[model samples]
Target: MAYYPAEVKEAARGLYCKRYSIREISRTLGIPRRTVYHWVDAEAWGDMLSHEGVEDAAQRRLVLLITRDDKTKADLQEIDRLTSALERFQRLREREQAMRGEPCETASAKPEQQDQRGTREKRERKGGDSRSGKRRGRVIKNDVSHLTPEDFKAQLHQHYFAYQRELMQAKHYRNRQILKSRQIGATWYFAQEAFEDACTTGDDQIFLSATRAQAEVFRDYIIQIAQQKFDLELKGNPITLHTAHGPATLRFLSNNSKSAQGYHGHVYIDEFFWIRGFKELHKVATGMAAHKKWRRTLFSTPSAVTHPGYGLWNGDWYNARNKVKRQQFPGFKEMQSGILCPDNTWRKIITLEDAMAGGCDLFDLNDLKLEYGPEEFENLFMCGFVDDTNAVFLLPQLQACGADPAEWADYNPKLPRPFGNKPVWCGYDPSRSRDDASFVVIAPPEKPGGMFRVLERFKWVNKSYLWQVARIREITQRYNVQFMGIDTTGPGIGVYENVRIFYSRATSIHYSVQTKTELVLKGRELVESNRIQWDAADKEVGLAFMMIRQTTTPSGAMTYAANRSESTGHADAAFAILHGVSYEPLARPRGGCRVVIG
Candidate 1:
């Protein structure tokens, strides 16, 4: 409807409010004076035009205050008087224009030379400096400063992956978690925004990185942005800068978050996923910010699914992302708004696939695939929560070999053990204190190397060594176990000697790094080949499978063990099963049948 665009019209009104002549507006806009005058008279521009006089008054008063050589209480009061008169003048000017048929009916038209003279007067009053061969009246004006917020934001995301821009512009910035691909510019974007905010506001920005080196890098970047855009040089022990509003500080700290208390400001935790003692550090850092209602943005690449960060990312926030109604955990409960606004913590996940599809060329997918294996790359850049770094078995492979619920129900420990002529093998893992001793009974396939179907399982805690031996004896006699493998570590040695005193078929398995590796490899072979099926519905057994982790030594030797969490104690149940399957029976004497160890 209007001749010029909305922003141009707003800028025109703003300049007019600053007391720019119609001719000046025309030349600036590259439009004719008649067109400018015509729009300034339109009903649509009436509200803006009336407010222009008020804005002009305020700007004049503020400029005068800034230019004064020595400002006093009386001067400040006069500035306030000018501010209060702004609204009254706007109304009076509007009414006078209505009666006179033109805005500024009594004002004289001035020459272009007068505008230049007025600017020089203000510069002189403000004690302008000429050391750089330019008047000090105007501050730094970069091309980027002219861009609108939306324009600058869009340009910032040109190199971003598909979902990255969406994530950056998300309404939620206060409490946010971003699990992203490596080198995706997420940290860079946040640092830029934080520094910009600090330059314009007096708020302090606190950044806690995984290491001192990382914090130093972020500090350098923020300082660089400030210097480039504002021509401000910020340097010191703590990285301090003086902004137009006041003194703002950007403090960078490493992973020693325990000493990060007593600061009320914007908090950013970088590389959170890999931070040592992150669970404790997160509590300390976030807890300090929580009371002050400070903004918090946590950034990191995905780590093990067992990580606490993973639980936070996948728990309540994950549910919200899927648009599902679910119960929330502590600190994750819905805000009173429940409208998914910026005040709420926003969770964002962006993987390499999303980046590649979004036109990011920083990384070649083929090259990454070769450098890091598919699983490793997926975990690192694809935002996958899989424990590819240390997992003995992938969750997917384990799922593929999962037994149906009905099959598992049939083998319930509460039900009587099934009778069969099939050769039964037992793996025993023994622990005396602070751990549970467990055993898994498995039936070999009808033919060799076919598959092992786990039929029964047993676990006990706080039992005497003799009691465990009695339990083993009962199992061997009842199931007619062909070959039994038992752990011979610590108390296990006594148990093994007692078992062999009665049962010749039993074999003692010494605990060692090599022996453990052999058993874990055998289990891995079964899982990879889909040659093992176990009850997926059994939570205890399933948890054991999940806890299995493979650690690689610097010497290239690999070791297998469970990541015993407080919730899931030692993975004796898992080792018990592996030991059972490790048993191999010797051929019976030609005329004799397979001997049962009783």
Candidate 2:
């Protein structure tokens, strides 16, 4: 018992080098279990406890249980809260239905279906009182290089919704990151932050980008709302009160992501997580227009674990949350010795209904401990570091067919086909030196409900791929495949002739043979875009040809070369030279049979 400083001996002991159970040491030494184990002697403790020093004693088990990390607990609580809210809402809805004397059982139930019911004829919002949300006055400042807190608040209020205020912050010019969440108002908050910066920070430009043109179009409301609601003049360079007559110059860009590159004052990318195809994102990253003084803020709702936006936000938020966790962690030492101490005290906004079962709020904040907790924070708030998942569309939007086997075939997914009895069009993407088999198939929708159904697909190992083309004759006859398109690399006339010979059944009677290249003219005419009806599947070089179709032709025959890539034949340069035919449907028949042949 020759005394040792309180933590001096504990600091030297490490996690498992202790004597007695963690609880035993704690009770014997009048110290917490974590500290007791920290001071334990490993040489002697090894004979009694495991490497982690967790023991087999019943009392130690009861007292030494590891509590959950905070973020995890927060997520669990959120799930519970949402689930509970949904349940309560459903019950309330049913009660309202009963009051109205309607069937309250199914989604398709009608009010007139039931008669006898409850007493009250009306229903209101949840909780005791129907009032929802707390209102707070906000200030927004503009037209200055810097801002007072009051001015900033004014600017923020102009754009901040109540639910969004939690994620909103003073715009930091040095950082470029995205904010992600589950049904959170991160995007709207960032928009407000950008609007404030655009108005107040002189010479600071602001660009708020959304996933679609429709979505970005709504950002104009910020200016309208600020001017009308707040009675603020967000015009003439909210920067130097100078009379530069322009439309409240906060430019709202739609997926105009490329424009976001090489010029950065302030770029707020909304719904960033849904952006697929890293090629464009990489352009923004490397060409990030932000000058030394510019900043970028990305915001989106979380949809996938591997989204590029998800990866980025996860990184910074992870480290930040962990800092707070380490600070309170009794045994662990702090790793980051830096200027920014982590402030991980984010309180969740819960429904009053959620707290009814438990006293006050029963959100358990300890379940969030994880190696990826900081990443979760990044995903939940700031998207700074991102993953590059090679996708061209949002995963959520890219829903594959269901597991139900019957719906596999004849199931008109999406909408009705766009073709409208238009002859089926086909495009062939032959493999170059690649290992996978060349894929030649029919695609494009006719009506809104039209979707791509693989009529015939094949994998060719060698020249035998052409052997499969013979089946195209049967498929053409089977479906109404009028015209077939092929990739002929570049100006290669010789290879085109060779593939045409292989596909031509005119000599064999399998079906008519037409070089797919020649069909290009017909595809230009009939196929809306050499591109496709946007069946929305990943095409090899198919998308290139489709862009060709988008181009309006000089002859009034729509040109098929509008938004094509440099490597037109890159996917199947040789296939373009191959033979494919365009079958144009003719007018009426003689005997009233009305031949609908292609």
Candidate 3:
């Protein structure tokens, strides 16, 4: 089930208040019927992807500390001790104040308590951080006192702290996948490291996009911190962050076009899988490449499937700090063998095969599902893609369909009668690329009583649609004059139009045309799933019906695939007529045929 975004909840709630019908509510929400009900009640309201609720604001910050490896056990213990001591010391001081008659004491003592609780280690270790000779990856690590913004405050047996300077200048990147556990402010710190690119000695461009609206909020937090702590201002108005240089906007963009264009900077796309389409993302990446000195960063919230941005961002600056800390890395099989990866340094946490492996006694699907959502979950998790796994026209069925007739002494594509050499039923598939195709054919059996043996199964290829048409016409006559169905989704329409004009000049066969996409919808309506069956003597009729259905099968399949929740019918009328003939005898004999009501 698709979850409703929180911002749309009020609009969703207004449905009952406005007393709109479910259909009207859906129209208002611009969603499907199921989504209308999904947002109808408060429980459904909670289903909205929201982070708001009752929690101590500081408790929220507490998560920041526990998640990263900046703080140590000793530091936490000392903070606790100082806090308790400071609390008691304040009580005694307040007692002394009572003797002198002041207002009841407040947590005013918290300042000194906080001083001891928060900064006691800072003071104790102030000079200690300057101590030298702590050699780390290509750089000497300093104590907490000598930490750089890029570095986490160091915690031995934990994460490396305060190493930003060393990270940027690291000689080589270790190629590995990194998986951060929960409670590691890895996200904030990850963005912080990227933000450091913005604030460091040399300026750099950055782009950050989120899967959903709230994910965009994380970028705002990073920007706010950059402004207050690091002297970076989010630029642009109607404003997002603007760069000090030419036209690089450091703005939070939703996964849509809002975030994809007009930037020449290192991209930091967060929660990449949450966003559905990447057409815009590709456009932005290509635009960024045009800038020459660009870099890219990707942040993900570990959705059910990893997105394109994650694989691509590995090329440029990724978390060198994570590598320094020995965090696990991740990879992608979906990215076409890492073709999208950044050239400089690459990392991945898991492969598709390992992602589906059973690690413990109880196998968990989180490995597969967590990396991707349903739309991508199949490829990311299942690691296989096919047109239809359980298609009725299975390979075996298709093999049977393509099988040569036993009665034929020799195989031939030559037409036998009315459609002689011209063509009859054209099966057009526009292009079986992501877009559906228009399958078409001209003629099958020469006469009305004959079967439609396979003609050209016209697959569409653009620009050279003529190549296909030329191929079809090469065998079939140029001027026999029969009806044709051209897929027309891609070049077929233009081909059909242009061919009609050319043939009017070049040939005598007056070809009538049916635009397959338009006609197929009508065809599906006629079939209505009543079941098509015929007898031994009705072989010609049965083959004609099946041929008609095959010509229109793609449309029916697409419609049913989209509306799998509902039952639909089939297409019969589309194939009922044999061929549109140019010349016929004055009185054609009517075949023994009846439209059965049952």
Candidate 4:
């Protein structure tokens, strides 16, 4: 532990006993604030210490004199004789005052005694702090005095306090995991914990962050806290404090397995799940801390199950639970049981729900729900884990209504036989840049309210707006297209205008939050209800559908688009189909007659 020099320590004690603040003592001592804190033991050097010590010493001396000194015993006998003589002398003085018409001292003291009793009874009736129901237990209050300055700051946040209490209360765990909702202040809380440990302990501690910017942020916070709260300035490079006990240093580094090499200290891994090569980093960190009293904490808001942190949290428990459930029941949904921490490790999961319930005001749940939509908000803010290996459209769901690519390729769009005399609708999404412009033609059902099927699909790269419009015009004329839904967002506006001039049946859809949302909703509804079918062997089409992913913004806005893979394109094809579904296909084949049942 870092400590102050003898002179500085003396100065700190003097100022502290004089009721000077810790910051004031630190400034006077010209030492690091934390060092001053370590040197000034409040319990040992409180407000009444000197007076109580002097009184105790006098009493002890009196006892020793009575027990071991005959001379002192004789002196005490004389003192008692003098005390009785003084009492008689005082009584004689009072009798003389009464003869002179002066009031007796006893009469003056009676009401004072009555007043003291009345005050005591009144206090008892008031019940002190119990009436307010805010009385804290002595033990709990005592623990606060043990906290370092930075920890005291952390206590101001209730969630952090509760988290620390849980960790401290656990008997068997040295390692801890904090899976928390985003923006819930876990980073700040742990940073304070690390700062306190570095300031108060002789141990060398390492703080790792996901990026250089983040590492600097964590480091800057420590320096700021030291300066603002303790009047300590951490100057010079490689930030080290030379103290009476030893040299204490806090080094911040970027998150990497290599950074952990040849370092021995408590390890703080911030945003552990977001770090690349986290598994390797974890291995290296644990190995470095294996021989020492070094402790490690891995914490993050969850992402995909592919993240190494998720595996650490769920893998063991999932396997064990899976085995037991399979034995009990032949079939069961695969549900992750709970986090199974490693030996001497603790795991805690705190969601936005928990934080809000605990009266945390950092996040508005309704806003986040709208921004992230259900799936993303649930994963990031709800402390819910997701497996995104099959992102968006699952292969099985897509394959249910999928047809063979060979059959789809054999049926030419020029022939009228394949369309089955049904009115065909085309959905168009145009892109002027590197993204491919895609269009899909759908064949409506032969009967009323029947499923729609993909008749033909095509994507054009480096195609001119005029060329795309010509193709739309040609398709409209060849297939006698009933209705065309075209995305009028960005470059699509020009295409929508030109196509409308040639093909009057085309509808321009101005893409906005509501429109895209409705498009995705309608697309999903069509798929789920088995109202739409596509060719299975069309890899580009499948990839486009798979790329459709939704994202939420911090301001509580949502957007949906393809995941954008180099192998395929931005989900223009998927959006086109989504647009096609908006027209609803009229739900009747051409030349079909409706009966008047009523």
- Ranked by lDDT from best down, the candidates are 1, 4, 2, 3
For model 2, give the RMSD to the true fold. 29.9
Tens digit per residue, CA lDDT, model 3, 509-569 = 2112232322333333222332111111111222223232222244444221211011211
Candidate 3 TM-score versus the reference: 0.28
Which residue segments of model 3 deviate by more than 4 Å? 1-189, 201-205, 208-217, 220-249, 258-260, 271-277, 298-347, 351-598
List runs of model 2 lying over 4 Å from the truth: 1-166, 176-179, 206-215, 232-249, 256-258, 315-598
The C-alpha lDDT values of all candidates are 0.61, 0.37, 0.36, 0.58
Candidate 1's C-alpha runs over 4 A off are 1-128, 131-164, 227-231, 291-293, 316-343, 388-598
Which is superior by lDDT, 1 or 3?
A: 1
Please provide, for model 1 over 146-251, each residue's C-alpha lDDT reduced to its tens digit, 9 standing for 90 to 100. Answer: 2234543454435555555565566245677777788777777778767656654546788887555577667888767656654445555355544334455777
The C-alpha local distance difference test score for the whole of candidate 2 amounts to 0.37
Weakest 10 consecutive residues of candidate 3 by summed lDDT: 562-571
Write the residue-wise lDDT of candidate 2 on 1-598 in tens digits: 4444433333233222322345534443345666544445434545545533222232233222211122356445644555555566678877897898754332321222211111111111112223544332111122222233476566455444433443353343244443333333444455556555554433335543433332343365555645654454443212222111211245544344553544445555555555555336635743554366555555444445554444344344455556655443111112111111232222222122222232323233332212112333333333222221432222322322101111122222221232223345454544333222344444434443244333334544444443545654554544445556544443222223454664452211011223322444443333332222222222222222322223343555543232223322222321321223222222214442322112
- Which residue runs does candidate 4 get wrong by more than 4 Å? 1-161, 164-172, 236-238, 317-342, 392-598
Q: Pick the candidate with the highest lDDT.
A: 1
